[model samples]
Target: METLRNWSSLCGYFVFIFLTTVSKDACFSEGSACEAPTSPECFTKNAIETVYNCEWSMNRTDGIVTFDLYFNSKTKFEVFNKTWHTIPEEKLIQRREVFIWVEAHVGNSSCSSPRRSVVLRDIVKYDAPQITSMSWSNSSLSLMWEAPEKHPALTEVWLRGDGHPAELRKETFTRINTDQVTVANLSQHSTHWVQIRQRSTQVKSPLWSNWSPWVKVPAELAHAPEVNVTTKRLNGTREVTLTWKLRSHAAAAAAGVTYQLSDTQSSLGCPCARTEKRRHYLF
Candidate 1:
């Protein structure tokens, strides 16, 4: 049987599962969690610069392998040490993955301790992109929005509030960079609260953006549009031309204009109203 040997290392990042949760605890158990090297000790950790020394451990019965480390700490807490000694640490790291560096001597004569390094990285997290724009049809809504910026990968987006967690009953989208999207098969006259989360391609972990503002659809029957506005213009002598179509009337209203023109009405109406600025009016 080939025994475990030569496990390499990596580094760089904000500590994620390994540091904040796993690696930190692993290192702490060895550093100060225990009483002494020969006996046992539990390592303590801090927020920043809480790197841990590593070693290996093996199951006595089956020879399953593991590693450990130790640290010197000073504390009145009866659990922490004030020093950072690592000489007795060697007895700790015979079989485990280590993040902190310790010294190694070559021979018994005239030797300097060399530091060892462990390679570990933080897993990245991200949130889902929001739906910027949405429009409704009979039983569906046409959606459009900007894609999420700077994420490893988008895993899934879901429409919520319509069913249970398992019976979400909405189509799933995994596309990125396609701002304009379509969501079909919706009930009419009801609101849909959507929540989404993404994952990094590097590791199989989920990162979710904030939930978008809610959107509603008709859960029952629907109505059609009366008219779609396509153009508008202000003509001479209190005349406003409003042109819209998809129905019959393609021409302006017969009145040619409609208004109760007045300058003495109120000075407080609009102080910033603009007129005759390239066939445009602003107020």
Candidate 2:
């Protein structure tokens, strides 16, 4: 019985040492508020540099808390002897996952150590482009834009055109590593709407930016004659004479032009009918 009691005591001592060693290495206790760094939010990349900030907290008031930073499962450093540390740009650009933990030491007590681990997954993202200039000539439209602030290399741009007359032809342009694009074969004398968006192919799981605001190109200039109208009235009767003079100097000289005159009240109420009634006029 004595030998059995001694063996039992020796086993209990070994168990206590094992538990203490485990606690010393990783001391996170139950109910302790330890938060891991969040992905994307914890990592930021800009044109100049990429940075990572590791943050965590502990509930124990009697212990000193320190942090360990890791990248790709490799220990990088112990948070400069602090609870939070910022990984430099050089280290941040190499890895996608960041692991951090808090280590707390409470006085000389046996259960004084605690640890909590946090893992963050992040991907680098590129900025969105902005349209800079637009020009139109004949049936071709040209667009120019500035590249995104970050990850500008190997970018793909999408240009979309929306036109009037519902049945009007639609045009789309897709290009890589280019900042300017010209689209042709657009209908003459019709309004066209255009928008552009871009994404970078530099990283896995690339993110596409939101589409830019719509831009409008007004109806193309007509190559037809200009007309001046004059009205005359006789003093004795409800009779009027209207005369129109056509000027064919600039645009009309190259193309044949014809004109038609119609009374507003008889044909349609007003010029507003051209749009509201979908009236088609030939010149």
Candidate 3:
């Protein structure tokens, strides 16, 4: 019983300390507004938007806490009763400085956050860029992605060779202003994977979008496969056999490889091709 009483006293002391610290750091006074949510951020997801979507974080204290947002002391902007709120396009002047703050109400007490100043046009975050096409030529990979047609943006391209250990794989990053980029000196023997992300160059402070899904780049054929041919005459007929070594290196690294054979005077058939056995290999 004595030990249980001591533990209870210790827990009570911790609770008292937490409340006192929270009151000092999170509240200005007994009735003052609570401190602003932590790391409040506002950003526009598209270039055509004149306002931003803002969000913040708050420690959920003892009661249900509802929030109200304001812009430059204007009328409450859509009391969403949540930590995140989107300002109406016509509510504030664009391309100009605006002050943003938040108010929190719990039970009968209310608290307001310090005002944060920002320029509506400067804080922008775009959506992930989409890959349109990709092609390989002369040991180089060229990729094209879709973005704002007229609004120039800076892009980052990430490329990694296929069929390699994570630590041993070669990866490359390229920064470019155009929507298309060409990376040279890649091996034609191995396939490649690539992803892209971008941010607006016109904005003073812009956030990069999340990376796009990784796209596969198949390996291009570097040269024709070598083969051995043998022929003999038997029973007034000619028989021929052609054999080639399968290349494990290129075949395993590539998405897939296939071969084709054609003759001008004779059409060869095989069991797999379902052609006449007399004119082609039976098996």
lDDT of 1 by residue, 130-185 (tens): 55444556677566655444333444556754444354654556554445455677
Best by lDDT: 3
Q: What would the per-residue lDDT of candidate 2 be over residues 18-91, giving only the tens digit for each residue?
A: 22233234334455443332222233333344565554444435445444444534555664335556676666
Q: Candidate 3: global Cα-lDDT? A: 0.64
- Model 3: runs farther than 4 Å from truth? 1-38, 45-47, 55-67, 73-75, 78-85, 101-115, 161-177, 220-283
What is candidate 2's local distance difference test score?
Answer: 0.46
Worst 10 residues of 3 by lDDT: 16-25
User: Which pairs clash (backbone N, Cα, C closer than 3 Å) in model 2?
Assistant: 27-113, 27-114, 27-115, 28-114, 28-115
Q: Using lDDT as the measure, what is the rank order of every candidate, best first?
A: 3, 2, 1
Question: Against the true structure, whose TM-score is highest?
Answer: 3
Per-candidate TM-scores read 0.33, 0.35, 0.52
lDDT of 3 by residue, 1-283 (tens): 0122222464465222222224322444455345446535678887677667877777666667777776677656545456887776676666788877777776666666667788777878777877766555677766777655356677777777675526233333434445777777878887677787877777787887778887666554444558798989999866878787654654434333445565434534533344423332111
For every candidate in turn, the CA RMSD to the true structure comes to 20.2, 16.8, 12.5
lDDT of each: 0.35, 0.46, 0.64
Residue 227 in model 1: lDDT: 32
Each model's backbone clash number: 48, 5, 3
On a 0 to 1 TM-score scale, where does candidate 2 land against the true structure? 0.35
C-alpha root-mean-square deviation, candidate 1: 20.2
